[model samples]
Target: MAEPVLAAELRQEAPIPLDLGFALHPGEVTALFGASGAGKTTVLRCLAGLYRPRTGRIRCGGETWFDSDADLWLPSHRRRIGLVFQDYALFPHMTAEANVAAALGHLPRAQRAARARALLALVHLQDFASRRPAELSGGQRQRVAVARALAREPEVLLLDEPFSALDRAVRVALYAEIEALRARLACPIVLVTHDFEEVARLADRVLVLEDGRIIAEGDVGAISARADLPIIAAAAEAGSVLDATLVETLAARRLSVLDTAAGRLVAPVIDAAPGARLRVRIPARDVILADRAPEGLSVHNALAGTVAAVEPRAGGLADLLVAVGAARLRAQVTEDAVSRLGLAPGRPVVALVKSVAVTRPGA
Candidate 1:
């Protein structure tokens, strides 16, 4: 495992009881994911030095930002962190260039302008540098905010619901921007978001928070496969994320063939050239489990796997985790179907999925 660039252990009793510990490594994006009032923002605040927990310690890049036992504390400005808020939080009177330049206080005054312009260009907002927040579109404004945050050359980047304010189209565009930024930044990025799609699209790891506590922590696939968790079960679209590489595209059929750890998968045509890597989402509800492979079916994919777990949910539904080689697939079936199929741990099964049901994470 890579060494953690940012590590924190925080505890508090009032306002919202929180007891959480996690670490982020260089170039890793760890998402603090949960519904509202889940202490996601509080954790971000604690890391940024905006909110001090009653007890615990925070360390980043070999520096102790907070140490309760040692009576050590660092103010927000003293800690090198880049934070992008949901509202953009740019000065209304200042142009995009000025706003980004304001964060270059650590550099010599003569160098601030050049660095600011460079950062703006990094975010593809160089042409909009003279526009104020009100004069720019939501997406452009967000790009400026990201540029401003990068101006600090922070050791860690903190994003608090940065996409919640934007529409789906804009959010999708920003998702690509963030992915591009990730390639250029070596800093650990922490994102606080309630959207599972956001977690699927950008996060390398997920920390599932519930009522001020982290109930689960793991990679996106593992966490999403745990349908037993209330948060996972309650998601509008509960699914497993798979890493696949496009092998072929049947343009006429409007389908794409991808190879995954589990097996070959056929998904709706993805707008990418062959050999392109992609993250695909397989919703639990769309998966159909069969004791053996069916001879003829409309399903385009049937992956062989063994049952790892069977979690019974309310409404006569049961969630099954099927271990398909090194990958896992989540399926939701009726309890009666489970009994009829004799589904249990160690049982071999075939997971049937239609091409239309499988999709790219942010598609």
Candidate 2:
């Protein structure tokens, strides 16, 4: 891995005990994923210099931001970090342009306005420059907040549930916008969120926190496939994330065909052009296993694979990891089904997935 652009080792005792360490590489979006009160936000705060841990060291871009042993602390304003809060923290009276310009205090007065406008244009909000936060929709307001953060020319970007306030449709649109912005800004980005779907869509890596400590950390696909982990097992949306490319769009059929490492899949019409890369989420509950191909069925996807593992769960349910080509698909079935199908590691099986059940995260 390349040298980490941002690194931290934090330790605390009171008000949510925390003991964790992590590093972020340039151009990598690492998510602090966990449930409420799991200390995801607290860790983000410590990194942003908003809260100092009892004993910790924070370094970014080869500069020390905090060192408890030396009793040295760099205040939030001094740290070259851009933060987008859960709530759009824009001044109600200020227009979108003014809100973004407020962060350009470090630049010359004459250059601030132009720089702010450029930032807004980057987020595709150039026309809303004169609109105040109250006049803008939730998604528009969030975009303004993002534009303001970019005006700081930060070395690291921190997003704290920035899309939580938006509805599903708006959130999906913002997901695409953020993905575009991320490619342009090659800085390390840290996202604090509890939504697994959000993590699957936007995060390159994930650190699962429980009781203020990191319980698991890995690439999003690996973490999502760990049914043995409490967090993954308990999530109703437990599933596998596959990297796929849009092969073509069948407008007449109202479906899009995608090619994945596992196999070809047909899904509901997606809004992207052909050849676009996408992340597809296949919920475990939506997958069915069969010993051989079924003659007649409405299922659009039937991938042949070998069983990799079986994790029995409460209520006699079992989670199976089926390896298809280079990818894995997770399927949840009853223990009875597992026995009847003679399911076990190395057993050949066919995984059935419905066209409508296949979802593109944030779509």
Candidate 3:
């Protein structure tokens, strides 16, 4: 694999001790998630040059931004990074366009406004260009902040709980917009968030941190399948992310057939053409176990598999990792059910999943 666009090895002593390292590839979104004081924000600060680490190396696109061993440190302004803070930090007195224009101050003053307008259009806020932060809605203000950050055309984008301040409805809308932005921009994006829903929908890879150290790290499916991570298992949203290709679309029934490693599965219709590949999330809670072949059921997908592992969780619950061919699916069931059904590794089983249970692409 090619070198990551953003690479960092960070260690700090003040405030909270942190020792962590990671690499971020282009066009990928890596989320840092944990409880408050888990050092998520600290990592972002170090990457942005806002906090110099006690010892570490930070590189962006092969450019050395910081190297404690070499006694090198790049100031925030010198490092090319676009940061969107939790609070939409727009200039209160400036219009949406003006706030974006402020970041383009290096350009000719006359050209900044037009460039700002173009960016606003890119973010679907062309009509709100003239409105000030105070006059605009929370979502519109955030769009302005995103535009302003992109005005620098940084090599990396950093988002720190950017949607936490917005209402649920508005946050959902921004989530789609951010995903759209990711498609248009090729830079590596780092997001800091405490919301698991946000992590489920926005993160291409997740890093779970605790006490200033990484407790778990992997793509969504791998992380979700591991029973050893108490942090993930406790969420109750643990599940697999399957990469599949749309093979057929049943327009009348509003369903699509996906070819996956586990087998052919049916799901709710996605707005993608046949042959297009997409990721679908299946929450462990949504899966059903059947020792025998199920019949007279409305569930659209049932894959034959064997029990791979069974883990007991709190509250008399158990998680079963089932291996179907080359793919693994996690199912959360009550401990009583496990005992009644006699489930364990090497046991034959069938996994039933509803068509609608398949999650949307970011999830």
TM-score of each predicted structure versus truth? 0.93, 0.90, 0.94
Q: What is the lDDT of residue 253 in candidate 2?
A: 90
Show pairs that collide, candidate 1.
Answer: none
**On residues 269-298, what C-alpha lDDT tens digit does candidate 3 reach at each position?**
777888876777788888899898778998
Q: Per-residue error at 294 for model 3, in Å?
A: 2.0
Q: Write out the backbone clash pairs for model 3.
A: none
As for TM-score, the candidate ahead, 1 or 3, is: 3
lDDT by residue (204-235, candidate 1, tens digit) is 89999988899999988788887778888778
Judging by lDDT, tell me the better candidate of 1 and 3. 1
Question: Candidate 2 residues 1-363, lDDT tens each?
Answer: 899998899999887799999999989899999889999999989988889889989999989999999999999999999999989889999999999999999999999999999999999999999999999999999999999988888999999999998899999899888888888998988999989888888989999999889999998878888877877777768889887888998999988998888889999888888878778888998999999999879788899999999999889999999998888788999999999999999999999986433344332
Clashing pairs in 2: none
Shift of residue 333 alpha carbon in model 2, Å:
1.4
What are the runs in model 1 whose C-alpha is more than 4 Å off? 250-254, 273-275, 356-363
Q: What is the C-alpha RMSD of each candidate to the true structure, in Å?
A: 2.2, 2.6, 2.0
| Model 3 / residue 30 / CA error / Å | 1.1
Query: Of 2 and 3, which scores higher on lDDT?
Result: 2
- For model 3, what is the alpha-carbon lDDT of residue 112? 94
